[model samples]
Every structure is written in structure tokens, then in C-alpha cells.
Target: MTQPDNTDDALIRLFNVSKRFGAKLALSNITMDIHKGEWLYVTGPSGAGKSTLLKLFYLGEKTTSGQVLVFGTNMNRLARREIPFLRRRFGIIFQDFKLIAHRNVFENVALVLEARGEPRAMIAKRTRNILRHAGMEMRMNAMPTTLSGGEQQRVAVARAIAGQPEVILADEPTGSLDPKSAEIIIGLLSAYHKRGATVLVATHDTELLARREGRIIRLEEGRLVSSEPAVGEAP
Candidate 1:
């Protein structure tokens, strides 16, 4: 499918992007644009390269060929010292909820702001507010191991948004949650997107696609198969 045409509004652009792990090709010739304030769903079956595509955005995995441009900067040419600064512009949520094991829920979220050198008072206030929104305030002092999968993921979501990042990249965020928890997670993401943050969700959950309206891009065997609006959605 032809991709979006408004280059002026594009926050991320991929041109002939491809990734290979030894003999295994993870992504191939991915050329597209992710516009600012857009909510995009990346859907595919297992081993279809959904996660790898998201990784390229945050620099988790380097592409073997082609370029990934974020905020007008080419990721392939980014300097080592510049990576952390570039990553601060993004909020990434992993399926496993990569919270610090020793840090409590509040600390886990607070650390993001702290790393950015935010003032102590502001960090405390924002952390509390974000956790409250995620329904994790009550468990502020609880460690990752103490919280259920749903609770941990909630904390992960809270941490991701604490910095008010311009973009959010979530990989299988609701894959292991219960139906209600999944709904809650999606709701939180949708709320963030409504606030003008770009959101890219990698998921294979049909129920999730049904619950939300957005542009959907499907991948198969490392290649983009389709890019279109959801059924009943206005293009």
C-alpha cells in the first residue's frame, strides 16, 4: 500500500529498512512514515518481525541495511554518546514489563524523570499523579515481584509516560494480561495518544484491534503485507 504522504507531519521515517540476525532476516525493506499524533497498530503472527520493527525506533536493534529516521535524525548515523538523549524522546513498553526488580512502583516510575534531571518536587508529584492514573498509587511501595502481571504492566505504562515522551512504542503490551487488564492497558495508551503522543503498538490480539480504531499494518515473513485503516474506520 502507498504510505502516508504528509512528510512535514512525519515523526519517524523508515527507508528500505532491513534487519538480519545471522542467517535469519527479521525485517525487510520497510519503508513508511509514522506521523506525529498518530496511533498505529503493527500486527502479525509469531516471528513476523513486529518486535524488531519497534526496536529499530528505539535503537534496541541495529538495522543491517537502510535507515531509520526519528525526529529528522538518522538512527544509523547517530553517535554513541547521543543515543541516551535520543531515547529520552521515546517511551517504550515491553511485554515482560522490564521494571527494576529492587525498585518500588513509585521509584520505578520516578527514575525516568530523575534520569532526565527533573526537580525532586516535580518528579514526586508527577510520579504520584501518573501512578494514580494507572491505578498503581496504592501499590506505590510495592516491588515488581510483589505485583501481579497486570499491576506490573500498569507500572510499566506509568513509567513510560512519566517523561511525557513524544512517542510510545509498545511491544505486545497486553499479551500476557487478562481480558480486563488488557482493556485497561489499551485504555491508558489511547488516553496518551489522545494527548498528542504518537503510539505504535505491536500486537497479535484480534480483540485489541476490535476494541480500538487506528491504522493497521500487517507483516508477514519480514515483509509488510498491508497498511490500511481498520474496518469501519474513515481514512
Candidate 2:
């Protein structure tokens, strides 16, 4: 976990990481390195700690024990103010879009830059750029409720990437989309990866993996089961 020079080689790393809720252990002794610009698949059965692992990276939940390092800094020792700064380096997309229903798509994405204290003009410019990338430019002024599930999710993706996070953590991003829609979302994530952003998608959908390929890390019973790199996939 303390790689020092090699730490920068990876955007995320976990060392002997573990988390627990009362007597239920969520993750047990997980240690690994996710290289910068690498696309990784976190595949597993339910209750396998995929979500828990992602949470540790984003500081969404505290690790009951062990070190969770992002960009080579140990989050366990990060001060409260430092935590926010660290989170800004990585965009996290939970299972739900977590959009503010009263807000429009533009506002949902703009909030990111706003929170970062970016000026209004800059926020507006970046907001529009990310929305276009997510193919939701036409829906900018629309409210979350006015859009379909796929559209709302697109808004979430736009918001997540609008800040230019070095890493993107997606938890079942395509879980709710229909077959065709799912393909489109995954493709968008792949596009980000191709652009040199480290991407980790926690999913159990074999169909998603079947369509494309990348490095795969399977977790079962809260343990890392396998790590395989998919090279020269037909897709």
C-alpha cells in the first residue's frame, strides 16, 4: 500500500483493508493496486463486498481497519478537510443516480464545479461540455423526473466526470438500463478509459463482460478471488 515511487504507478491501492458492521465483516484483508488509466472489472456474487470496497476508495464509508490509499495518500490519516479534496480527485457513481429531482440536468452537473468554487462562467462551460459528452446536451434544461431512467443515469455520469477526476468508480452503472441502453453506458465508460482515466466498475452482469473485455478482479465472500487481464479482446 505504501509504494512511494511506484505508488504513482497506480491511481488506487488498498493494503490489508477490512471493514465491519458489528460482527458482520464486509471486507477482509484486501490488498491490490489499480494502475493509472487501467480499466478494471470488479465482478462477484452478492454480499461479496464490491460496494464496500468502492466505498472505502471514495471515503463513502470508513474502513473498520487497514489503510485505503488514493493517489498515494493514506485516507485513514486524512483530515476532514483533506477528505473532500481527495474525493474530488475521483468521481464516484453509486447504484442510484442521486440526482436532485428539483434540479435540471445542467444544475445537477454544474453543482460539481460549484462545490469546487469554480466561477459561474467556467462552471457553465464545463457543465455543457460534460453533458455533451454523455449525449445529454439536448436535455440540459430538463428535470430528472422528466427524463427516463437511462437519461437520468446519463446525467449522473456527466456530473461524475465533469470535474475531471483521475479515477471513476461506478457501482452497477448499467444495472438498470435495458440491453441496448446498457451497451451505450458501458461504451461511454470505455470511452473514458481510452482517454486515460482509471475506471472500476463493480458489477455481476456477465452479459456486460461478454460484450467487451478488460482486467477483471473477482471478489467472493469478501476476498479477492482472481485477477485476469483481458488482452486483444475481439471487441
Candidate 3:
């Protein structure tokens, strides 16, 4: 299949990518080129390895056998020390929200910038701005546990974007939100895509796909069954 003509016409490329847990074979020869500045949905039934695929892109997991390239470097051949450097291009969100209970929202977002050795002034400015964009500035000093589920998830989203990564991976971000909250989060992500970032949303939300601007690929039992263009196709 032809890949999208996006910002980095030669961005993330996966060729015959597969992963296995012993003989379980979690993914099998999944190949695709994810261009820059495109929004794609990695849709699949349970146990289809969608999560595993996302993990590989973020360096959280490695492929068992395949050539995985990000930017221009081959991941499997890279050194352990290189992994952290490679992941700077990505922002990730999970269903669990992964917030530290003891940390307030500002601290949660600040943690990312701090890890990268960003200056205090930069961290404060960026964290505050990102929280405002995420609509959580007022809750900046509130603990994650003190906020509602939706609010906590927004903080996670804010932390991810505070760095302005080249790629954003959202693993079931809207799974437990009310319709209004889901739209708010989803719309924010859509806006990011519009501003030119590679986005892969691992989800089963057909409703969102119905309004997609990129493409959808479905995985079944670790095998890619089909690929389709988004609804409008911009024709």
C-alpha cells in the first residue's frame, strides 16, 4: 500500500515487523510506513498486538524480527544508549493515565521537561502553557488523585504534549470518558495532527474512524487483515 505523503516523506518505516512471546507470535510481518503529520488509527480486536506495535514505536518494546526505522536510524541495530535519544520524537498516552499520585498536575507535566534537562524557566513556561491548552491550568497544583478520572487523563495528555514530540501515540485514550470529555480530548489530538505531527491512535472506536483524516489498518490475531483509506479521502 502507498503511504501518506506527509511532512517527513521518509519518516517511520516498518518492514516485516513481528514480535513473539515464546511461540505466541504476537505480531506477524506487519509492514507500514507512517509518514510525518498524518493521523492514523491502529484498529484491531483484542489480543491483536496493537499495543505491542505502539510499544515498539515508543521503544517500550522491541520487535522480534524486522527492520524498524524511525527518522533515519534502524532501531534494532541501535545501541541501548540510543533508545532514549530515539524516543524523544514521540509522545505517549495510555489507558491507565500513568500519573504519580503524590505529584500535582504541574509537577506531573514538569517531570517530562526536567528529565530532558530543560531549564526551570522553560519548564514553568511550557508546563503552564500546555496545561492551559489542555484546560487544566487551574488544577496545576492539584494531586492526580484529587482530580476526576477525565481530569487526570487530561494531565497525561498535557504532559505528553509539553515536549512537542514529532510523533504522538495514544493507546485507547478515550476508553473511559463521557462523550463530552472524549470529544474534548479527541479534538485536542486532532488539532495536533492538523499542526503537523505523526499520530497513531490505537483504538476500537469506530465512531472516531468515521470522521478520520488519515487511514485505518485492522489487525486480527497479530496479522494485518486489511487496510482502508479514511472516509472522505480528501477528494
Q: What is candidate 3's TM-score against the reference?
A: 0.94
Superposition error at 211 for model 3 (Å): 1.9
lDDT of 3 at 20: 95
Worst 10 residues of 1 by lDDT: 1-10
Candidate 3 lDDT, 144-225, residue by residue in tens:
9998878988998898888899889999998877778778888888888788888899998877777766788899988888
Show the lowest summed lDDT stretch of 10 residues, model 3.
Answer: 1-10
Per-residue alpha-carbon lDDT of candidate 1 for residues 84-135, written as tens digits (9 for 90 to 100): 9999999999999999999899999999999999999999999999999999
Top model number, lDDT:
1
Question: What are the runs in model 1 whose C-alpha is more than 4 Å off?
Answer: 1-6, 230-235
Candidate 2, overall lDDT?
A: 0.85
Cα lDDT computed for each candidate against the true fold: 0.92, 0.85, 0.85
List ranges where model 3 is wrong by over 4 Å: 1-8
